[model samples]
Target: MKCVAQAGLYEARIPTGAPYKLRIGWADGWEEGADPYSFPPLLSHHDLHLFAEGKHRELAHMMGAQTMTIDGVAGVRFAVWAPNAKSVSVVGDFNLWNARRHPMRLRHDGGIWELFIPNVMSGSRYKYDITGPDGARLPLHADPFALASEIPPATASVVASPLDFEWHDEEWMARRSSFHAENAPLSIYECHVGSWRRPDKDGTRILTWDELKETLIPYVVDLGFTHIELMPIMAHPFDGSWGYQPLGLFAPMPRQGNPQQLASFIDACHQAGLGVILDWVPAHFPNDLHGMARFDGTCLFEHQDPREGLHPDWHTLIYNVGRNEVRGFLIASALMWLTQYHVDGLRVDAVASMLYRDYSRPHNGWLPNYYGGRENLESVEFLRELNHAVAEYAPTALMIAEESTAWPGVTRSVDSGGLGFTYKWNMGWMHDTLSYISRDPLWRRYHHDNILFGLHYAFSEKFVLPLSHDEVVHGKGSLLSRMPGEGGTRYAGLRAYLAFMWGHPGKKLLFMGAELAQWEEWDPHGELAWNMLDTPWGRGMHALVRDLNRLHRTEPTLHQRDTHSDGFAWIIGNDTENSVFAWLRYGDDGKPVLVVCNMTPVPRIDYRIGVPLPGWWAERLNTDADDYGGGGTGNAGGRSTEQIVSHGYEQSCVLYLPPLSVLYLQHEGGAG
Candidate 1:
């Protein structure tokens, strides 16, 4: 780092790795302190090489305000990439936030500015006062790689180290690679910690990570879920955005607890046999002055052109993935969650917006790519590189994409020209199923195809059937409220729908409070109506979800071959007039699990349904049972198959299908 101290802009000579104070013609005569910039850059040569090549996977180590000791002087090393800035300075409370107190030395080769200021210890709040190319002072910006940030309403970057957590989940980490989720049952309970449960109804306080280990952990375990997918925990200013507009990618929200406590919470989950999947947002960021927007008085992280950079719906700026440094920065953020926090997976948010250049934009407001197409080629390439790096660094941690488009090969291997994700959220399935189930029961017959339509493309990619927060927020009603009925009928409908979703050919994800059939649409400020859990309908839905998850994990037929077409066979798919559907799910052992669903409030008694073998089918579960608050109308115990052939099968049975319910029956060895 060389400084310009003279009127002629001559570079001053300083001693090797020694601080030598030089007099600046414009400053007060005879500055006493040695020049901090005269020291060699702490950023490694390999880091610069990989960054220039657009492939540095760990940018957090080389950039930002990292705490380190250079030349036995305890201080923080500040580094930033501002290609267009004329000068950059480390301004903070230590120097009374004056812009000129600690001017940084620029590395002309890579446009990086760096300085090692001694005695700047942890807990110091800081910012960068950048002199733009036009020599104008821009708004002071927070450190992009700040390990921690000041609590919201106070937007200063705190000097902290992220590696302070001592992990104790080596057993979970060692065996994670063996559990390839696609081959195993993955029933995720997606939850927002702040709103999931509050200390009281007044929304007085949020449950901390320590508090959660005792409550949220055991609750999910008792419900028999395999994993917990948390809403974004990254530090963000606006609470209404639901952590989607994150500013601190590296820091866990201190409001929840310190970074290490968040780590301990994740460790607790792993120790309790539950995997943790974090919702990660790398697509866009809010235009808050202290965040990434206009850093160094230029479009440093975002694109220079609004048409190519701005997100119309989110009112945020999109990351310019074309920039090598930006790509590395985002990839490193994803890695931090896995490597540092021991997270099991990531649910990438708004991937469709990242993949398309014209997403949510009018024709006049968007720009075409280099090939004059809607595809964002740079983002596509960046995604490939990101996935590649994740595989190399965190081999067991899954990368799941929330892509809503009919993109050709989202989960395919990148080697074969694909984006390389482990699984993709089945948005099409969620939409079509919800639409069909919301219709009046009498008119449901007309739209029976809506429930079965997603199966046509189900196997195109590994899918997760998510009844997520997005479907219950904004103007959309809660899951139970979406059903077109009142009182017991709606509860019955939701139970039947949950059965269908569980038996569907994919992994499962259910948002919190959905199992309780919460009536209020999701509100960020309120805790879930926990009092509902004591009601009959609430208890019934809860019981049903518990059984669903338990059964899903125990029965190999429900998950073993989930990603293939062979596991499923329709027995009553085309019975639209009756609004009834039946199917058989099979495992490797050739045994079949029979499932029947009645969408209408009309029971079909003594109805003949085909069976592959001549055996007794025991009624394993009936959503219409009295314990579940239904009329308890179902086949008593079991039914033996008759000699009569029906529905193109060798054997058949006359059975009862309860109104607005689903039944799971297991074959009892050849009717003995």
Candidate 2:
């Protein structure tokens, strides 16, 4: 007994199905059962080698608390990486939250500590009790790889079952390759899950995953949005951060129900012919104590240097991208969502912040990379490796970047020395267009270049023109409120802006509530004013958006040549005198859709515009039409092009240009 106590080792077998107590210390004895140390190593040497090299893209299966039934002892195998910890233990309700009850054994390969507790069934809450390098008591941390977490107001990680679901999305998975952005109609609806819909006004309860399946899927399908981009579904401590400050990178928040329920929601989306995109944040994480901050009582997940690690704008901690394990961890989390949850894509948030070392900082406040350059070399390499890993793991899954900079090759292939993203959010266009439209129409002609400047570099990258949640929140006001005019003029201007955006030369993305022309700035904690649909402006605005989405999808000329510069050309490039702009969007087959926007409040009569073909031009959509609660100043049904040439086109049309309206016209019965 003395030798066993002194050695702190058990060479012989302790009988199973009994509580084994270590009574060597002055404190109360440990009533730990079935020595987890006695079990063989969970990970192989090769696996550890790869993890250290930052190549372990499938760590989701290895690093987290995995449900296993080894030798008929059904329980969870908890594993965590804290290389500098003096000692680590798995503490939970099973052991009365006593850290000494189940001390985990340190792994030899990569500083991973692991312990398997028998009969620790699913739904049991647990956390890691880590001792720091200097032997200080570190705060217990929530599991970084937990598949599900306790509902907010609690910070424990739940023991989740192996993520297995009887998925009925075989058809979607099989045909996903065809849905890539380059060849498909990509219109995304950016949504915040909790704020998307609520039954009550006080914001007490959020819609569950099951409830969302019944509501969100059908709504998106009806609106003809190809994909619904959810703002981070990962488990976060604060609801107001909107899942941006995540603690459990692998776990879906329990507030929405279990992991399987979220899976079922995704399955329902696929069944209803809607793809789902998750807004993934790998840029920075909140500095919550129970989170990645000061992990293992050291700056493990983040950089030790504040200039390099802390985000100036968000007050969060930036990931230490130079660390190989961190890269592996980040990539693995991304792949887990794509592979396990069957998510169609990931829109990587705050990529511009990640790319630059001196982002939002007074130049000297930040550090330079190896070459003394402002570009973060480590972050660049990490992003490249992440994109490579995602491509290899989930070939059809998209990697989008919300990068606001003019950084070249953002959507270009890695082989060509670019970031290799599938699509990029056009922040430049969003900001410029919004600024231009906010000007009074009387002064719009003088600032006409603001509206036309985007086309100069429109095809620079695969861009998703976004009027996202960022535009509507934080006192930026709603889309309806952003217009320069008031009353009916504002409504007409907003509808025109939307139509123009839909016809613009990029993939489309619109935030929720914008379709209803919501006048109030978005409130994360309150339900949207859905009852506004009863009002005239609201009903008309809602109907206009539905028609716009339908028109955007059905018109081949709008998207077929979107990636090419030749697809767009100016028909009336210099007619800024009356605050008017005309352009043509062309299909690859040479068919064209002509667009004319009138930004002023006064209607123009006998306005002559050029058309590609001399035929009956149908009025496909008019933002000022009575259908959209406008003054309805537009050509009745159609306009016939005159034989007289104008603006160097083969023919011209004299029509009524409605005030604060944009018109989409298609040549009826005209061939290329």
Candidate 3:
């Protein structure tokens, strides 16, 4: 044994042969373990090269704490990338949280530190003890690629066993592509697992993944929703952020359960015919001490300059996507959800923040891009690369973008100089429609453009008309409460608006609780207002939503041509004074379906509207039906189109337009 430069530290030079445990005795105690230095490096030179090139598709397998059997000796191999760190060590329960017990060796090629700790089993909590270049010990950081983490309020990464999940989603996996096709019905029910249903009134307890599988899965299916889009379930420190600010990109949030339980829940969703989509936030990360902020006492994962790095609105650190390692890390996080957990899709959140350098920044607070433009060029490239990788790895998985801006070609192909998202949230449409629907019907004529403006760009990009959680939070009140009238009128208006949204030219996404017409805004601290269903108004609204989803899925004309302008045409779009709108929706293989909406409370008797053909038009749905809390004012079944010329069409239909309601009529292929 020889004394090293550090005091009270010694190195032993022993001939290497078969593996054996080494023991050291101190004045008060003793410790035993196989020397970490004695083991060969776990990552090969090629692995380091790929990581350096930012082309490593499976970095999760090489980085973070992974349980393995190295040279017939079972242990956990820990690895982290901190190029600027002077030294790094593994600190955890096995070593009594001592940084001096197991210092890691740095591989200079890729700036990765690794070490194999003998006899370290899975489920052991750990963190990295890093010393910056200035010789100052930085805060312990949770593993960037950790597959499992300790429940919040406890910051540590857990050594996870290799995934041994026996998946039973073969049927769903084999045909999910069809489910995501543009022509297929896409009705997404956006949900928050924590708030969907809680066991206690205080919201102190959270349900496990298995519990959600039993509750949420069947609930969504019964509601007729095609998919359940969960708000961020990634590991984040703050509960209020709603998983927006994630620290553990790879780890499943321990709040719900372990990673394996999550996989089982996803499996259950697939078996029940419900697709799962996770809200993925890669734009910024919170500055929690145990997270990736100021890692290695430097802006390692984020931009060094505040002008480029800090997100003004959120006060979060924006990732430095220009760095190869950071880009690779983010992409791997996305792939982990798709390939590892078997989620159907990822809805990238706050894409507007990532696409613009001046997002939510004051004139003097932001820096211009390299070309003197406001766009974030590096982030743009990173997004394109991420989409390409997802396409290559998980070809059938959807990559939706929650971008709020009018950025061109967001859903276009990347090879064609576009961002290449599968679908974009139609924020403009949502804003306009909500503004129009919220106004008093007496003054709605003045703002009629709000209702008609969305169609001008309806087919600009593959869109999803999202009535998301953003609309019902922070004192905005629930969707039901946003109407401009009292009592039954409010219920009628909400039903009309929902029907309008479902019939509009795009996919559909509604936040949880909207179906029941809850009056209170979303309370993240409590479960949804499910008790409201006991009320007549709530039950009526719930029934309407279920019927709407059923019709949207079964009627080809309602969903098949959602993305093509050729499938939609206006029959009476210029009737602002009457506050009435009419349109025709067509599918390749089905007869056209006519839709008419009356925003005012005054019913229009014998209202004339153009029709494409003379036929017995069967009424498919009426928002004014008594079952949906309306006055039951509607035509008997349906009306036959007369050969009277109107709105430049040879045929016309004289109909009883219900107050604050919308009607859907399908052509039955016979002239009256």
Candidate 4:
């Protein structure tokens, strides 16, 4: 196998005693040992350096040189990676989608399809016309590069840019930095910005960042959520995706606002004392022709085969991480959000898919690991490097993974055989809790183990009890919709469930309308049925939710950071009667705050539950409080010094238990 050395190639010498023959080129040729030409064509050392420099400059141009000065007007230099296309053109407000008027030049050196349109500055509407092989004309889309607006597919798109806003977030950014430094407990209010607010009437309304600053920020602050986890604000072409199919990683969705508007939104959240964490989807991208697909005359960033590049379940294109340029682009995107956007953190989406080669497995299409195993080692290495870069570039920015697999130590430090994510979504708890709550009351007892099972691995890599967007979408129904029993019983059960959620071990997250108990599943197009707030039931649920947030924040025992091994004590777990679950959250000073929840519908006359400590206790918060829209069976706020009675072999406290209620008991001086 003999071939002249070519640019962009590398060679290695074989050992003299090596017994292996050399195979080169496309497997059509072979040679005996010590054959110099047997080695693959190698790029000259100088050419390789030039190639590396060119690649670096290309990336720097995209990231650093924000406004590409052209014709005395600063516009962006747009580029897309599309190798399969024969020709590509830029069309937008300037060219009106005309292909011939704005044909992009091809850079054969890097195989990049590029165009530098003069006078087409930020806020210029655009799409691409990509002519694929066989004369198939496809409209190339917005480069995920610094785009300001997107049509959100199935909706009209307009021209917008990042330079169109007044931001006020310096103070907030400083405060957020301090908060992260202290490792403060984060309670995230995950929301979709568009659907978070809409016009009172129905003719297509979008809430400006100012509008959300005026309305949503105060509400979240009052609700006591320490952080706001926004659904992907990165520009995407589909509204139905809930912002998952990102077409532009650098630009916030134009429908919401320009880059400045988004900055203002984050600034507003910071001013309101809330940290912002973006939900980032690097797992796959939309296969919109107007986007990444073959924009550069090749499958430059993605795998060539549909089987290798496409996400079967999501119908999207997956990036080829093995490509150094592609990997650097993604890493750069992550850093861009942290450094430029000043985002407090990121929740990496669909990481399980990214970490696996045969994620949604097919019929023997994927390659095996080097050791003939069914693992994707390349993917794992990519994740490890990603985490390392994130930590190095943005120490304060938390990196969370939405990894549902049993991949061990996902949240552990990179040096410790882990992916080094700050936290991973506790999918186990979410599944168990949702399943248990959806069952009938009689059967609810049978599923009592659900809560306890979650606790078993509760401390495994810091977990977040995520009642996320997934639960509200895909026909899963709203949180309230999942409750069992009828009318008041159902309401009480829902209330008890919330109380239990907040009282559990791990941080908590509630999607957009869950705080108000919106009965309908999430609708991406409109507000959260604010009219529901006018109803008595709605008002009651709203107040209860608000109070829950207040309770979670005000009580040191309820704060996730405070309720660790020092504070957590499981007093009772009885599987026989399918009733009686009790746990205690204590203060740093060892003062106990007990929680006893009975899932039964009937009042228990003399329920005996063992107490972790022997002492007087006071009712702090109860789901059955009259103000909370529950029956008046709650004990008034005061201390109780009852003597401990014997139940079986354990010393216990017997109290009249309310059906479908959570009782919180704290030692007299335990309040923190």
Candidate 5:
């Protein structure tokens, strides 16, 4: 054997040309592995070109540790983008965490360092040890595209084979486009799996995906909700972030079992006739040492300038969306969940923060865009590109935005110079309606505009009226506790408010504990008060929510024209003195459903409201029903409209309106 020396390492020359493994014996034990340098780079020139151009929609599959067979040998291909690193190495349990054992080969075209380490199979934990451009050793970096990760507190990336779970929701996937159509019913149950229920008394035991499959899926299905919107489930280091500040963009949270279990949970949801929407954060990320904050000892994922890079509120680093590679990275992450996990939709979080450069910043604390405008032009382009990619790649999936500002054309098509989201959270509607409902009936009259103001611009964008977890957290009180009334009156107010929301022209979303009228505000660290369901008010509130979901799904007039201007018309919108509101909703078939609400405690006998059809109107639902803990004061069955012109209608109906109640009346048939 001949030995040659280079860089303080002695390499023994072998006469054989074929690849071979080496076994090194130590004082106590021996380790054996094939040299990673024996293999060629896995990434191609075209992939790098596409990524550099911000068009690599499948980058997640290429950039991470992917299992493969090269030259008749099975192994895992590890690739990472660290352009400024002086040297990079794959270090893990396979090599006894030795960085010197496998130095990666960097392809200068895209600054991508790659190596195929044979015998490194799935379940092997690993990370990248890098020497910075300044020749200083940097902290080990977790893979940004890791498909699975070590549970938090153990900062290592786990090697995982691609998700290969067998799906049993063929029927659901086939017709998912129809389920997400604007005309279809979309009542979502916003849930935080950790706090929804606890198997233990301390509420510290978070439910795994398999646990949720057996519990959350059936519960949502039984409640008649069309979808379940899970709070962010991406891999994050902090439980307090609720998966918002995700580090592993492509990995499922290991706390919820593996990627396969999460996929199975989603499959179960689909089979149970429920769509799943995930909250995805793309605006900013925490500056954790192992995260993408200063990869390669540079601000690779975020802007270097603090004025443009830092998030004022969360103290996180704002993404450099203007960068081509960053845009591709984020879009690839969005696609991974939709395609690999079979997720139905992504609700982009902190969209308002991304939309404006000066969001939550003082005038001097922010940097203006190229045009000196507050609008983040680069972010706008990225969103449009992201939505366009989702539409092209996963046509059945939806891209929703949690945008609070009055951003025009948020849900409009990209071809028309819009952001091209399928839906936007109607934050204004949630705020104003909650405000109106929280007031005393006597004072509500003076704040009548709060309830009616939403309709003024209801059709501006496709909206999802969300009573999400935000309303019940941060000392704001539970939805039930926010009502300003005595015991029964509070329940009545909540019921009436829910009915009004359902009857309103938008899709619906309710948080987990709102159905049970849980007294405590949302606590991420604690579970919901499930014992509350044993009480009378709790049972009634739950029943009412179930029935409301049923009505929203079964009735065409209620959901068929949610985004159309013609779907809604007012009958007595200006009757603020009596604290009453009346309106009509119409479906595509022209069938009408009249809604009347009494916000005060005094019942109104013979309350007159106009109807378009002179026919027998059946009372479809009453918020004052005894089943929902109400006084049961309502029209005996229904009222027939008389041929008396009122409120510019050819027919009018007079009925007994219950105190603090909402009534739904549908035209049955025949002229009165």
Candidate 6:
């Protein structure tokens, strides 16, 4: 029991046995002076309400919810405010995987089930077994109030209460202000923790966050990615659903690690000079009863009606953002992660669903916004408020949207007729690129417009070129699979496409395995076929991606904020033949970079390519280089710029462009 005073505020500590009111300085800097001891309980409560009227929205939401207590034992002493359910048992790991052995006692006040299982240690797992009104046996259920973790069915998980890890990220944490101000180019490497690493043999061995920190951190840093956009780490009840069906918004999945372990992983990333952006799913949650569906005797946090509550395609329950308490709960949850875990950014998942009331639904099943559109007014308001609060509280943190619709002003400031996000995924680019690449090499000419068409929207809200987790999953296959040919040609084609991706106007993001040209669909159970790293093709692709990262960092033309009309220009060639496509990228200093790509499978003969300047241009990078598993059809190392010439048309030049290869030419400023 000690006391001290600082900045006109009195701080006092009391023994654990005493019942005392802990007072802190109010937001208005009010002091509890003089007769603080003589204040009556009722009068003090009234005064507290006066103090709370404008400043305690987050605390107010917490007050209406059921109270929970964690006994000193390693496990939690949970008692939901639910006044229903005929029977309930703490049925997780503490009960030896039996649902019936440890039934909870029904308290007198309501139908609340109470239980304290001492054996349910921290890092030990458990769930509830609730028997409903008509004798329906609900198996071990996810906890609505869980601040830690949940398990996927058919695969049991343990509860890891937080860990205490040593962190060395104080410097990164302090630089938050400058980090956001400069608008540094955000090159994100999006990854799914589960699928990113699993047992090589696959007998249900999961790689923990600790393992990822040790194994994946160095690889990512070596790859030169500035950030890692983690696919949802929030606790969920299904392995097949990815982390999108979130059951615990405030807690990292225990299946991966304890909260502290997850924090350590993030800290490790920061130490390696990488930002972490979490994929946050706020659109809907799983319908599992043990989750937020029907706790506290009703659909407390979700919409009551099916039309408003259900996401038909996802088969999940939508949150009622219209309710003040629910809105506060969600906003508070977002703030909690930012504050507690020090996450640098959040990629709001499925934002298109949240924006439209009729998203994936029939006309009669939807509501309209104030403008008489399918836009959900409440959701819009919630998002606006969320962004505003994020800016106010965590100004350094970036908010990105996985929004596909042309939801006007999504990345604009909320007060300036916009949604106030830092960036929005260039979903159009992803679709167009995939569609174009999936076709045969000969047919690429017909679809060539898709690539340029994507550039028209490149200026839309600070875009990020995302070949994200979505592309590899759901039967789309890996990037290598989407290429036109087989063997070394396919590998070369993939390298060409990746080079194009890196040199594009926007920020870049690739899934974990894409750097290595992972042949199979991504699996959540094991490490990226690490064994493939020894192969020549895999190593070549990996090296190319690493070099691309270096190129992005070293070249100012590839940065985000430098986009201008003159910064990029496409050089027209034989459009009908679709034989070649060329473009120039210029930095602010007028240093030009010429890029020419031939989509044809056969070697292009005497292909005349028009460059922007007549000066001698050196081939900086070529996909046809022997080092990248190409046909060695390009200039051998230093012989690239030997007497290259130009005609008119913006200082145009001609060259023999190679087939299925991309060439980068940098102006060397003299006839060789």
* Per-model TM-score versus the true fold: 0.94, 0.95, 0.98, 0.83, 0.98, 0.80
What does candidate 2's lDDT look like per residue over 117-144, in tens digits? 7768788899989999999988899888
Which candidate order results from sorting by TM-score in descending order? 3, 5, 2, 1, 4, 6
Query: RMSD of model 2, in Å?
Result: 2.9
Misplaced by over 4 Å in model 4 are 1-119, 126-141, 150-167, 181-183, 363-365, 560-566, 638-652, 669-672
Candidate 4 lDDT by residue in tens digits, 302-371 = 8887756888898889987777667766776787788667788999999998777788977586656688
True-structure RMSD for candidate 1: 3.5
lDDT of 1 by residue, 1-672 (tens): 354765333565555655455554445553344356556677777777777676777776778888887766678889888878998888887777987778887776667888888778788999998888899988888888888888888888888874777777889888887665577898999999999988755586899999999899999999999999999999898988899999999888878887778888998998898999999999999999878898878888999899988999988999999988888889999998888788999999999999998899988988888889999999999989989989999988899999999998999989999999999999999999999999999999899889888989989999999999999988998999988877889999999999999988999999999888799988889988777788988888889999999899888888988999998888988898889899888878777788999999888988789988788888888999888778878899878998887889978978899889999987877662
Residue 22 of model 6 has an lDDT of 32
lDDT of each prediction vs. the true structure? 0.87, 0.86, 0.92, 0.70, 0.91, 0.70
Clashes (N, CA, C under 3 Å) per candidate: 1, 0, 0, 17, 0, 10
Relative to the true structure, candidate 3 reaches a TM of: 0.98
Give me the displacement of residue 134 in model 3, in angstroms: 0.9
Model 6 lDDT on a 0 to 1 scale = 0.70
Alpha-carbon error at 669 in model 1, in Å?
A: 1.4
Best by lDDT: 3
**Which regions of candidate 3 are displaced past 4 Å?**
1-6, 16-19, 26-31, 200-202
Residue-level lDDT of model 5, residues 123-184, one tens digit each, is 99999999999999999999998988999889899999988999999999999999999899
Better of 4 and 5 by TM-score: 5
Span of 10 residues, lowest total lDDT, candidate 4: 34-43
